[model samples]
Target chain A: MKIVAIDRQGKEHTLEGRDGWTVMEILRDGGLDIAAECGGACACATCHVYVNDGWFEKLPAPSESEIDMLDMALAVEPNSRLSCQIVCSETTDGIKVTVAPE
Target chain B: MTAAAPIETDVAIIGAGPIGLFAVFELGLLDLKCHLVDILDRPGGQCTELYPEKPIYDIPGLPIVTGQELTNRLLEQVKPFNPQFHFNEMATGLEKLADGRWKLSTDAGTTLIVPVVVIAGGAGSFVPKRPPIPGIEVFENAGDGVGVHYAVRKMENFRGKNILIAGGGDSALDWTINLAPLAKSLTLVHHRDGFRAAQHSVNQMRELEAAGKIKFHVASVKALHGEAGKLASVTLAGADKSEWHHETDAFLPFFGLTIKLGPIAEFGIHLNENLIPVDTAKFESQTLGIFAIGDINTYPGKLKLILSGFHEAALMSQAAFHIVRPNEKLRFQYTTSSSSLQKKLGVS
Candidate 1:
């Protein structure tokens, strides 16, 4: 699957994501500077990003715990999501997200 | 010191984790003064608190070592430096002072001014997990009133007050045992009979309960009764039919520990994701006079292993010396080969 991550400076990163790897892993492997702290535990909000508008509704709703951590994320938006929660798949190809500021 | 006055040092390290501890040795060898601030009340971060008894296999030459033992060795290794520590505090505010030095403050209101700042926080600061109940903060926001409390900032504040503590963790059980004699009345409430705290603490809590020194209830906080920001009464809903109102002046909930980037998230330094992005050469952040190491930082081909952080700390110190002592020429020497380095360690 392919995904795009736009950094704070507007640098676009196109990444090849393996099926089992998360969007965070793909972004990190592409050297796009995603924290992914606590790895994929979903405990930390450092992996926060804003999903593109039309794609936001296509994804599953954020879990309660993820929502709780998202509340602590900086510059949270309605489309905000944790990249750790977004595992890569064929359905998620072409997913576009903007990395949230720390 | 209060917020108005700042503590002066050559370096201010943001964490007291393992990597942060090692940085003290590197910076100390360069004759730079250092002060470390951490959210944990003690050193060793996760190693000491989370898995003190767990055996770690990957710490270099040691065949195997307990987490606490490893932490102890590191602390002993850095003892000669006489590094000062400010525990139970999070680095909150960061800025560049007028004279090109950095000014940083903690959640405890302690301020630090230094030419170089090192961030070694592992996954940022540890934040306590709060109960999911709504309106709990309203009482917590009441400013040390009856309804809610998270941190026991001042033990004296609860003296002679009726206190209710809820949780099955170590903190809840320990506080129940500690405050039973001091409080006018103390109650330990949990959702179930089983607890995850130390067996001794659980036994002591039970002993106090049996002796009538403290009350124990197997129930959950269903609702709160308080007005004007003060907690008055708490309703406990038991598994049985009875829902009872327990009168209390203060409520302390100790759910567990969770990590958050905390105030570090607000610093003006550009973050690659939630991490401090640093140059591989010096591990310095994009901001001048500030360097980041350990798991809290990210760079190209970065590895988060503890040994990698140790490597980053060494490089960070050489760069830090340039900022702390601009006029002095750096003399790089190995502890294994240099008598000066061995003498600094008191190890020859």
Candidate 2:
């Protein structure tokens, strides 16, 4: 599977994805600026991202804990989701997301 | 220069995280007095700050332990050592003294002089997350309560002013409820209508909103408008994508904190991609009398797990002892069988 991430500078990079890995792991491994400070524990919302409108519904809905964590994030929107909670899979191929501001 | 006298100790540890706390036990067994400095108000570092209630199953002896419980246990274990802790301070400066002792300085103006410095800073210090607003720095620290403020130091400073609080967490809701009565007008802006705060606080805020004592809006502050370090108003991006301006003398955003390497990067120690490189055998950094452990240190086959940090702390303490007591012969003894060691732990 493949993942596409847009940098804060508006540059897009195509990254390889692995099953069972989160989009956050892919972004960090792909040399993006994703902090992922909690190491995918979903305790911090630093891995926040805005999914492309087309890809928003394709990903699973955020859990209550994720939503609670998002309350601490800045500039949260209707499409904002914690990238660490979105696991990469065959169904999630070609997922596109924009890195949220710090 | 700090006007206060420098605190003298055998060893100075930078962080009070799990590893730093455990290092106290190991160093205390060797009769080394330690002083720890941490940015957070409490111990446990990220464990307490980020996820105090989260459970971990990997701690060796305990089957499962929450972050806060592990911190409590570590505190109890190190109580006999009487290691001093400087909380709510960030270690910002490091210099080698003429006497070969290291002098460490904090943003809080406290200083420490020690023979050995151990950096158990796990992933660095947790700092308040700044909103990505342009020119926001000009409005920050603007005479206490007239401009942008991250934390409310004194509620009275905000009294009788037009106040705007942002965030959906407890800090925002609690401040809104408390400051509404004091402010000439109080407005709370959040990205969504739902709040993550306690139900009681949220209900109280809603009651205030209903009584027209406060205004609640489901919007995000997109841009700040101010002049001469005084905030005049803020541009709000409504949930419907429409924008509007709201007047406020003070703006407070309660975005949660994120970790940063912070001033440790300027401590003259070499860093490998923001992590201090240390020898696996001694866990000592390139600088003599300086050591790095936990997630802040990088070595071949290094693991950032708390268990790995505990092992590193043991090895680091041994090297620290040599620096603290150069003329004393090192003696290794098991705590279970060594009377001297047990005495230090107050278990004999």
Candidate 3:
């Protein structure tokens, strides 16, 4: 599965990761600047990312707690989602996202 | 006399929670000495504060253990390291010293110069949650230090005064029982007759109330009245909203605690909301020589579990080793395989 992440610097990097691991794990393993503070528990908004327009709708809707955590994320947008809540799967192979500012 | 010199160490750890205590073992394995600072008067953090008797099931091999029991075992495991502990103080500032070592200062004026700083504070520092009493701040102790008090820093200050202690928590009950004889008259105020303190403490409080030594008011504090910032009387509202003025000299509200990012926010490290962001490999923040583990830190795919913090501590200690001793080579060894490490643990 290939997932692309644009860091705070706007430099894009494509990553190949296995299924079952979260988008957060793929991004961190791909050596990007993502802070999944609560470690995929949907407890913190550190792993927040702005999903590209086309990819945002394809992902599952965030839960109540995820939305609450997103409320605390800085620079939140309509497409903002906690990367840890986005698990890796076949449909999410070509997703694109931008890392939120620190 | 000149002020005492700041304490120095190889690693200055914040928070003596389970993760902080575990970091002592991991860092000790690498021969890195550590000094811990925490805001609470006691160690164990949430375990002791929130739930001491509640059984936890997910702590590795321990099938079913209470929070306090787990803390006790961890304390025993790390005892061989002899880590220095600074309790009842909050780490308030972090600055780069002239010699390249970091100088960390606490609220109590204790300072320590450490080459590597480890933050294991679980959800940051614990700050007491102030009750929602209108204008209570007005009587929160003025020039002579008498009126409203959150914590009894000095029990002697309330001697021979009419004291009104609110809330049903341990702090309220403990102080109610301890300060009964000291105060001219004491009143235990709560919304209901039930209390959250230990049974022994509650029973002791009841005994005092029965003997008419201390009055028990099944009510809540509504308003404070005083002159010159001195507490004169407190209006207690009953369940039916019936208010009555009770003559009191001092008011103490022990409403419990809420965690805050506190002074660590001033450390100049990158913060995601309130947690420190770190690299998964080293668990070190964007800043060099500073590591964050436990619930205090954030990374991609981070889990706030104690087991995860324990894993992070091991990796963080490895990364901290180089910064602490640049000239020495790091040789990884297992406790089961390395005899020297076993000797250090007093097991060999």
Candidate 4:
């Protein structure tokens, strides 16, 4: 799948991912500065991001732990999602997410 | 060749938490002596104090274990050398003696002389800040603070219990989502209807509420009600001065910790709030012979993680060892040499 990650500096990177890979893993492997403090256990909300419009429905719902983590995140929005909670799938092949201002 | 017995050991560690415990293991393997000290009655720092009952899934080599259990395993892992330990005494300050040895003062009025000091305090030493609301102190006397908590590690504590959560941040929202399933009833209160959490988390909370799993309150907690020294209900007031009461078994507030620069600040250590500025390569603070590890130290691209802290501790300890013993041979040895010595004594 093709995913585009826009950082806080507005620099965009188009990365490739396998089906079922979380956005967090893709960014981390790409050496982006997304802080996944809890290592994607959904225990800490350090990997939050804003998904582009119309992409929210394509992603799966977050777990309870992910919600708890996001509660402590900064600059949260309607489209905020823990990147670790967003799984890549056929319908989400061209997902666009921007790292939130931490 | 026999090792020379110097006037002092290599490093002195403050705070025997996970990071400190790991420092001992790393330093011991490097054939250095570490004197570990803590103000707590026992070791393990925050893991033993705050979340001892909470299960930790992150640490390697153990699929899952309680915080207290992890502390025990860490203690066991570093038990062979019998590293010097001092407990129940807080480190008050550090003084540079005329002889070049560092003098550390404790709250108990004891002074310790060491060459180097490593601070590995996790989010343990700092306390969570209580929300500043008018008449909030009234709840403190009625044991409302007892049921109201800041950190959520064990779901059992809130399981089958009616819970009310406050805040729109990630921590507050995360707990609301996690506890919705286990709690008999869950109520989430945020200052604004819009959340500052992950979009997916907010979506999940909305889904749970729609499915009759939880309730949301877009207001701030105004007052806490109690009778006979236990929480009875919480009163929330909206922006329009409307108030509502909801009976709850417990109140879980996920507001983040209010961190301040502690004792290290007195020594002229340069810092921004609780974070210490450092050279990413050396991990050295503004003061010589002093190093800050874990979340306390900040750099250009530093990501605070337990694993990253482990790496920081390893790097800092090696540099500390070198500072104390400039000419000493630096070797990479996995197992501590003391273990072999103990095996020879049949103590293993």
Candidate 5:
């Protein structure tokens, strides 16, 4: 699977996503500047991302814990989701997301 | 301030994370006493600090364990070792003594001398998150009561000053309530109306705002207008993109904490990308008698995991024992079979 990430500078990078791996892991492994401080544990909201409009509905809804973490994140939008909570698979192929600011 | 007397121990561990906790057990097995220093007030490093309730599945033997649970278990396992812990302190300065010992100092003025120094600092120290505003750096550490501060070192410094507190967390709300009585003017600014802090604190802050003791604004700090390291005013951006300037002599932003390789960088050790380079065998740094493990250390095939740090602690203690007790011959024993090891664990 593949994931497209937009960095803070508005630069787009295509990352190879592994099945069952978190979006945060994929972005970090692909050399994207996602902090992922909790290492995909969904504890820290440093891996926050704004899911693209079309792709927001493609992934599963965030859990209550994920929503709680998002609430702690800065600049939270309706589409704001913790990338660490989003697992990549066939259904999430070609997912697009924009990384949130620090 | 006069420094306190130095504490002498067999090994001085820089962090109280999982790896450092386990190092106590390994070193204790060989009868090497340890003293650990951590920046956080408690143990578990990122585990307890970042995600205590988060479940970790990679720990061996156990299918799953929470971060706090793992820390509690490690604390229990090392209880018999009686490893001294100096919390709420960061290992700031490192120096080699003429007696072939290392002297470690902390921001809290704590000093420790040991033959071996183990750096289990995972991602370094947890420090306050700074607001990502341009030109904010100039306003930091501005002495004589004018600058941006993440923490309140002295309440007198903020007293009678126009202070602006940011974030809706406990620190901001608590400081708002405490400083409002003393400030000439106080403003609490946040991005949203809702707060992530305790309901009691939020209610208290609301009461203060209702009483007109403090100004509450649902806005984010956009820019800091300051000159010569002195903050004069801050530009705040509202939800509707409305911008306005607010006068303030001090800015306190408590957006929670994020870890960084802080004072560890100045320890005179060789660093690669802010991570200490260590050998895969002993996990020792370039400087003899000093070792780095866990996420803070980089080596061939190094993996940043709790389990990996556990293994590294085991090997590191073996090398640390040689340095701490060079005259004594090393004995390899397992906790599963050795009665002496069991005795050290207090099971026998």
Candidate 6:
């Protein structure tokens, strides 16, 4: 699957991920430096990222804990979701996410 | 050599995790001495305790490695230096001594004198806080068989069982989402309807509830019912003065633990939400001779990764060495031949 991550500098890097890996793992393994403190357990909000507006509906809804973590994130938006909690699937292909500025 | 005041070693490391161990390894390469301390009976800090079995896909060189194996590799890398280790002892307090030595007190009533302390605690010792529900204190020593659980690393523990999850935060939701597929029945109860997690997770839970994959309760656990010494059901009361009882086999409360900064806070260290603030490049704290590393240190552009912590430790060791021996030239000399070799290897 293809996931686009926009960094703080507005540079977008399209990463490839398997169906099972989360967005946080895909971005991190690709050297984008998205901090995921809880290792995708959704225990920490460090992996907060914002999804493109229209694309938000294309993905599964985040759990309540992911929303709680977005509250603690730096640049939270209505589309903010913890990247670790966003698991990739065939339906999530071509998803667009942006790493919020710290 | 001219006789001067007794100069202690360059740096003192306050943890033996990946960051602290990396500091030792780097400083040893620089031919500097380091003293490392940790409360864990062994090294690896949070990695050893929190997710020993989880495979780490990051960390530049290795494709994958378990937390325990990673810790072992780091220990092996630092073994050559013979860095002094103070294990099973927590650093209770820190004070700058008259001779410029850092005096550290342990909970065991022991004291250590060193220079340049590096606070490399990953989430400050990884002490899991138990929920404050009544009767929880009574079940503290009943082991995992009873209704007491300190952590939930895997979802299979609750699979095919009726599970009740508490807390309205990200961990609680993540657990709910993960277990919704495997659990026989799942109920998520929180203190408030508004969740403090990511918006997407909240949306996902609503969708899951709509699809009948799980049930959501806007309340907290008032009472837990047990049968034959194991959890059987949970009673949740809503804010609207409504109550419901659900039979459950496991009750996994994901309310985030209350993290304590402990004695490190007393060292006059600067912090943001209990996280020590450090210079991202140098890993040095506000106070001289006090450096912070790993997850505990927060700063602009601070990426809290094990690999990033390793980088911070390496740089901090060099800075600490300069602080201790300002006049001494370090052993590693960048000769023209070595520079050419580095160039050949595509290293700057």
Question: Best candidate, TM-score-wise?
Answer: 2
Ranking 4 against 6 by TM-score, winner: 6
Give per-residue CA lDDT, model 6, range B1-348, as digits (tens).
Answer: 232333345666788888888888777766668777687778887677556777888989899998889999988877767888878777778888898778776675556666777888776653444554556554444433235565665556666777777777677788888889988888887755778777899999999999998988767676777754567777777777688887777777664433355778777877787888787678888888888888889888877788888888878877877877778875554424566434433444
Alpha-carbon lDDT, every model: 0.83, 0.92, 0.83, 0.72, 0.88, 0.74
Higher-ranked by TM-score: 1 or 5: 5
Which wins on TM-score, candidate 1 or candidate 6? Answer: 1
Residue-wise lDDT of candidate 1 within B122-179, one digit each (tens)? 8877777666566777787676535688778777778899999987767888888888
Q: Give the range where candidate 2 chain B is weakest over 10 consecutive residues by summed lDDT.
A: B1-10
Task: Identify the CAPRI category of the predicted complex in candidate 4.
Answer: incorrect
Report the lDDT tens digits of candidate 6 across residue range A1-102.
899889878998999977999889999898886656667866556677889958888788877656655534433446778888888899888999998654
Q: Give the lowest summed-lDDT range of ten residues in model 5 chain B.
A: B141-150
Collision count for each candidate, in order: 2, 0, 4, 21, 0, 18
Candidate 3 chain B superposition, TM-score: 0.90
User: Any residue pairs clashing in model 3, and if so which?
Assistant: A36-B299, A36-B300, A39-B302, A39-B303
Give the runs in model 2 whose Cα sits over 4 Å from its true position.
none
TM-scores, one per candidate: 0.73, 0.97, 0.72, 0.51, 0.91, 0.52
lDDT of 1 by residue, A1-102 (tens): 789889978998888878978888888778887766556666556688999958899888888667655533543456889999988888898999999765
The local lDDT score (0 to 100) that residue B242 gets in candidate 2 is 100
**Native-referenced Cα lDDT, model 6:** 0.74
User: After superposition, which runs of candidate 4 have C-alpha atoms over 4 Å from their true positions?
Assistant: A1-20, A27-33, A72-78, B1-10, B14-17, B25-68, B79-97, B103-113, B119-165, B168-188, B191-216, B219-253, B256-288, B291-340, B343-348
Descending-lDDT candidate ranking: 2, 5, 3, 1, 6, 4
Runs in model 1 deviating more than 4 A are A1-102, B1-5, B153-156, B159-162, B181-185, B211-214, B239-247
Model 5, residue B10: distance off in Å is 1.2
lDDT of 6 at B126: 39
lDDT (Cα, tens digit) per residue for candidate 3, span B1-348: 233489988999999989999999999999999999999888798777656676778899999998799889989999999999999999988999888899998878889999999998888777765555678788875533268887887888888888888877678899999999989999988766776567899899989988999999777787889887878898888867788999988888876565677889989999997889999999999889889998889878887788999999999999999999999999999999999899989999
Model number 1 iRMSD: 10.1
Candidate 2 lDDT tens digits, B250-321: 998988798999999998899999999999989999999999989999998988899999999999888888
Name model 3 segments beyond 4 Å from true.
A1-102, B1-3, B141-145, B198-212, B226-228
Candidate 4 residue lDDT tens string, A22-98: 89999888877786654566645667899996897777776665665666654455678999888887888888999
